[model samples]
Target: MRYAKSADGARIAYSAGGAGEPLLLLAGQGNTHHWWDGVLDDFRAAHRTITLDYRGTGDSDRPDEPYSTEGFAEDAIAVLDDLGVERAHVYGTSMGGRVAQWLAARRPDRVRALVLGCTSPGGPNAVDRGDDVRRSLARPAPEGRRRALLELMYTPGWLATHPGPYRTLGDPTMTPKERLRHLVASERHDAWDALPGIQAPTLVVHGDDDLLNPTANAALLAERVPGARLCLIPGARHAYFEESRSVAGPLVLDFLREHERA
Candidate 1:
């Protein structure tokens, strides 16, 4: 993994592969570049895909500073600037989608097209997982925690066939303090007012059954972002970008290509 220095001199770790136009992939809360491993080749075939670990995750530095979606966007900007890429398509999932909102809104010229998957806009208008879902996610048992997440993230059949533990949730290596910081940063995101200012063509994709992020937020985001299209994958959940990749992936690719510069 190569490194880029953020505005604060934090070492942001990123990896790039494939060929063609640049495509930046951002991971969910507390996750690293490893989360995108499942769909890298598909994206690589069309664009030079780049993935990065958020400041406190993977190979990136863990500066003793508070985190915010805005700061994370800057980290992304640092990566693109470090590589001398003026603009590119961007795809973000979960919290990554939150970061993408700030990136697209705050740095419109650096974004060609955008995709937000299984994510929320945060703030007062965004939907929440409710108390029960929150309770399940807060299970104290490690095994129970993993099982609870797997159940919520994928359909029953998908989990049935894939009978093993996966690290699709938070970064296991992160300390409780680091994870809490990420959760706080994501919770504090408020992009509702900023969405209207985004100039890049946008596509908002989500699973109809995403209780964690609540599928309803997809409509809110699509409605708030001018001309943004929404695609809801039936029978999918929070990790739909991976569980329903065959459907969501091509839709996103088509959207990006539709708006590509000649």
Candidate 2:
């Protein structure tokens, strides 16, 4: 993993490999770049894939102070700049998608396209998560967290049948304070007004069975973002990008390839 120095001089850890157009994977809250391990090779086959750990996750530096989604976006852009990439096709999931909205909205020239999965626009349009999800958001028990998260992330039938898809719920890397701070940033994120200004072609993907953010949020992204397309996977849930990689990987690759730089 390589590290980039953010504008604030925080060391942002990231890993990038492969060829073709660059594709940045901004992971969800409380996750590291390793979160994309399930489908990294598949992406590498066609594009240069770069995934980074947010400020407090994985090998990245964990600053003690609070951070907002906008600040996180700056860190994301810093990763791109450190790599000398002028623009990229970005894919963000959950809170990462929320960060992507701010990045694409605020820095149109740096984004060629966007894929927002299992995320929301925030404000009144944002759907409140269920009790079980709210309880486990960032403060998760390593042993049961994967199982618990899977229950909320994938459909019951899929969970019963599949084994490898829901194994990792992230390493317990963040401290209690870091976890709560991340949640607070997530709660305060409001991209409802900023999305319409995004200049890149966008795709909003979600699982019909998603409960945490709800599939309704995906619809909001599609409706609000100009020229954005929406794809809702049947029988999938919040972790569709990982749990349903076969479906989502190809769809996202197709979308990015369609809009790849000339």
Candidate 3:
């Protein structure tokens, strides 16, 4: 575990590994750096990956205040500064994608490229999660909440073949207070007015069957961001990376490579 001080003097935790061009991985709401474990091995083969626990999650210090996506972007920038990375290929999922977009917009000099997955541009078309899903989030993490959440994230075939890192989800170490903070952070995220400013070469990936953010959100992002391309993976859900790595990972790698060569 490594640490960086945000502009506001808040300490954040991050993990760095792999060898090649730097690629920062930002996990979604309610997720920690451990969320990238499934794809890190493959991603690391091509690029150095930096994963972090945002403020109020994982090993990071939690401040008593409402979380904002913009603030999270600042946390990311602080991480980059701490590591002395002048620029990096940025990739984010769900809320992390929103952060990546904000980072690209706010600090274009620090981003080489941007990859957004299972996220939205945060507007009228963005809040597509249904009442049931919202209710699930509001309630405390139940005994089977991990499995239930995974079910909502991945398709049936992927869930059947790979049950996923159940230990990571079911870990008893995560307290209810921590989980609540994550839930609040996720619920409070709104970045609709911030999309038009992202200038990085962008790739938007969304699952055709995603219920959380929906495919329209991806469309909105691609339509709003200049030169952003959208790819739809079939038979996948919110957790496209975990559910369809064979398809998603290669597509992301190809996009990064193409941008790198451009």
Candidate 4:
């Protein structure tokens, strides 16, 4: 893993692998770089894939300061700058997508292409998960909470075969305060105004049945961003990038390849 110092002197932890044009992989809310372990190989096959542990997760430092998607985008920029990468393709899911919006808007020169999966524009314009879904996730038992999240994330058929650890759910390592901070960061994301200013070629991908980030948000994102394409994976849910990787993966790769800098 490599380290980058953010504008606020926060130590951002990031790693890079494979070979080809640089491709940044941003994770979902409250997750570490390992969240992409399943799809990383696919991305790595044709790109110099990079992943990072957001503040309060994995190896990144957890300072008690306020967290925001904009700040996280700066952290991503720090990682790129540390590696001397001037520009690259960006793929972010969930809260990561929120950060990517800021990255592409705030630093247009640093993004070659952009992909947002199962994410929202946040604030009042975005459709949120239902209150019942949120209440179910707040269940007392850790196992139950994880189960609830997994059920919401993937279909029962997928879950039946792929039992055991998935990195997207709550991490035992995160303190209550750290978890709340991450949630706050995700909740406070409001990229509505910034979407139209993004200059990079953009793709908005989502699962048709996503309960965590409703599929409707995908259309909203596609509409908000200038000339952005939208892809909806059938029979998939929140974790479509993983559950339907066979379909979503290649689509994203083809899109990125099409927009590769010459």
- Which portions of model 1 show Cα errors greater than 4 Å? none
- Tens digits of per-residue lDDT for model 3, 1-262: 9999998889999989988888999988767888788788988999888999888777877887767778889999999999999999999998889888889988999999999999877656464788887676456666455556666787777668875454234224456676676656655666666677778899999999888677778888898888899899987888888668899999999888887734
- Candidate 4 Cα deviation (angstroms), residue 168: 1.6
List lDDT for all candidates, in order: 0.92, 0.87, 0.81, 0.92
On residues 229-256, what C-alpha lDDT tens digit does candidate 4 reach at each position?
A: 9999999998888889899999999999
Candidate 3 weakest ten by summed lDDT: 164-173
Query: How well does each candidate superpose onto the true structure, as a TM-score?
Result: 0.98, 0.93, 0.91, 0.98
Which residues of candidate 3, in runs, are more than 4 Å off? 135-141, 167-174
Cα lDDT over the full model 2: 0.87
What is the alpha-carbon lDDT of model 4 when measured against the actual structure?
Answer: 0.92
- Any runs in candidate 2 off by more than 4 Å, and if so which? 131-146, 161-168
1 or 3: which has the higher TM-score?
1
The TM-score that candidate 4 achieves is 0.98
Error of 4 at 31 (Å): 0.6
- Pairs that collide in candidate 1 are none
Model 4 RMSD in Å is 0.9
Ranked candidates, highest lDDT first: 4, 1, 2, 3
